[model samples]
Target chain A: MSLKNTEAVVLSQLRLGEADRIITFLSPQLGKFKGVVKGGRSLRCKMLASTMPLTQVAVWFVEKRTSGLHLISQCDIINPFRTLKENLHKLVSGLYLTELVEVATWEVEPDEGLFELLLWGLGSLAAGERLQAVLRIFEIRLAVLLGYEPQLSFCLGCEKELAGRESYYFSFAKGGVICAKCRAGARGCKISLGSVNFLRQALRFQQEKLGRLTLTAASSKELQQILPAYLSYHLERKINSLRFLNLLNVRC
Target chain B: MLYTESLAKLVAELKRMPGIGNKSAERLALYILGLPKDEAGKLAQAILQLKERIFYCSRCGNITEVDPCTICQSPARDAGILCVVEWPNDLLAIEKTRGFRGHYHVLMGAISPKTNIGPEALRIKELQARVSSQQVREIILATSPTLEGEATAMYLYEVLKPLGRITHGGRIGVCR
Candidate 1:
């Protein structure tokens, strides 16, 4: 078998026997790969650092003749996300991002655009600026990428353009906005236009420019209500990591 | 035009794994066919050995070849301190840190009303017995930091505190 070299982010790892590990990674070129790293549990193995959750690395592996478990030969760290690890809130958010990517993306299906989006989100989180906003943007963009892009331009069902005065409902089942008229038969949470516009801008902005978008407490609270429902509707399950963030908020 | 009996059986076996579907299972079965004979044999042997040899430790509920497990038998470990975790896997996590020199009590799961898992469903009775009989000073609740985890910790604190001096462990302690 030939050795393939690529850049990847460690999504998760599981112990496989005495000293080896079965690692799940998201590679830019190769999509998701479940590979076996020999002696990964050993202290002398440099791959240990690269195998950490959310660490980006360049990996060299051999596609073995018989099993889907590629044998990792070497790994060089690209970004360790050291700052995210040090800070509790950021670490939880980073883990949430990783969990989302691992769940949403399919194995051996390359989506370069989504990979770039995830990398940018991780980098933004590591940089330690406007984390809440960064996370909101990431969630919106991810939804868009997955083909469930919210219809912010108008009422999702009514085909009428949204105006600043009216409050709209964000529906997970319907996959977008519902105007007051459209809300009669729809099931969702009511959100102000200000918050809707903020979400709209977040979806449109480049990942790096996400920090510039200001979120007031009102908008943030509205987002908290709307986004979770949006995610549960699309992903069909509540994210576990979100609870930790809510707990942290309560503590603070 | 159709798969043989052995190939179909292999696909069915592969599909049993979490998150693997029929298509992926078929892909995996095909991939296994491509491996060198010895390497594939080793993989198959490992699975068989795991199923045959690995059993839950009677005392702590951690996965081990022995009944009481190596940790329970280790003279180096402190019998007075017991770290409570949600799963056998969590026991491995605590052991990996080398920071805790105490014995462990794996609950097998946390109490989740949504999942219909209750205190009686877990190893709580056994844990209480261990605390009383083994002279455990502290019972660290190292469950996941979820709403259910917090509820479980509180329940354990209420139940164990009246019996003895069980410290009220917080989310920060167990998760970090």
Candidate 2:
């Protein structure tokens, strides 16, 4: 077993044995991994605070390659993002973001870009950015980072440039838009050109400039339907946290 | 050497328990096999009795053999002060301290977005019902200190704020 130290964000934790816990985390160097923390459930354990989900932590662990479960020796919280956890809506959004990362990633395969994007998402929520804007940006950027970037530039059916299309059919199965002429037999949903333009800009914006891009009501509604379906199509699984977020929105 | 069918079945069944590994399951099976016949019979009967008689108290969601539970039915306990916890074991832990004389409400679980469980999936509605119908004066948010637990506590505070005064972590007399 080799010793490794990396900055990771806690994804989720499960109770192990009587007082131990199995913590899953996402790291820049290690895509996703699970580590066993001894006595994590104890009220006075130092690991208690560091192991909480969505907390950015610096962890030193022994990688047990044979068993596939690392042993976390020491972990220190880098940033607790306390504000995100203090608000219910923000907390749910944070959990949903982490859960998506955890589900989309594979173990031990490093993806620094995705890791940075996750930190940005969590930081934005903690800083009190608009919730809808944060969710849409995170989803679009996540799709791009994972190589499932939506084909927003052209119509898939006739290979025509989609610069001035009034409306288009976004095919979840094809992962792009189909023009009106191509819509006869296409299995897709109609989306407005305004939503398309906003998404295209979102995809090209730098991380720092992403916040400056705001979503119109129509675009927000369109994206709220499109990106998730696109990601779910590519990832081949229903993201459970999205359902939880929907419930919270309904309550509001 | 392979164990007989009966021994293997016992080992398999024991392994299904939490924290029980193959070694522990085998050891426990052997210990049970070596017990006196009458003792073994009594143990089996006790397990059957537990599953048959034990159930959650309708009022507070705590496990009990009775409907309202002894704590709920007791006149000595304060109905106005309610201690809300994440699970029944938490209720027992606080009860063991014998410091608080208030009744309890077990939420059964916390709000965990990863698991897709929201406030509606918890005991929050029943809690609201209890608070509106009763003369509750103070609610002690004794949920755990974990992320999910804290979120659940915050959600509860928002929902129960207009109903009465809500204090966190059971720290009474420390005004918020």
In terms of DockQ, the best-performing candidate is 2
Q: For residues B34-72, what per-residue lDDT tens digits would candidate 2 score against the true structure? A: 999999999999999999999999899999999999999
- Which pairs clash (backbone N, Cα, C closer than 3 Å) in model 1? A65-B34, A66-B34, A66-B35
- CA lDDT, candidate 1, residue B129: 84
Candidate 1's error at A222, in angstroms? 1.8
lDDT, candidate 2, A1-252, per-residue tens? 889999999999998888899999999998899999989889988899999999999999999989879999999999999889888889889988988898899888889998899999999999965888888899988998888887888898889888663578899888888898887887887888888888888888999988888888878878888888888888998888888788777777
Clashes of each: 3, 0
Question: Where is model 2 more than 4 Å wrong at Cα?
Answer: A163-165, B1-12, B21-37, B162-176
Docking class of 1: incorrect
CAPRI level of candidate 2:
medium
Task: Quote each prediction's TM-score.
Answer: 0.63, 0.91
Among these predictions, the greatest TM-score belongs to 2
Model 1 alpha-carbon miss at residue A70, Å: 0.9
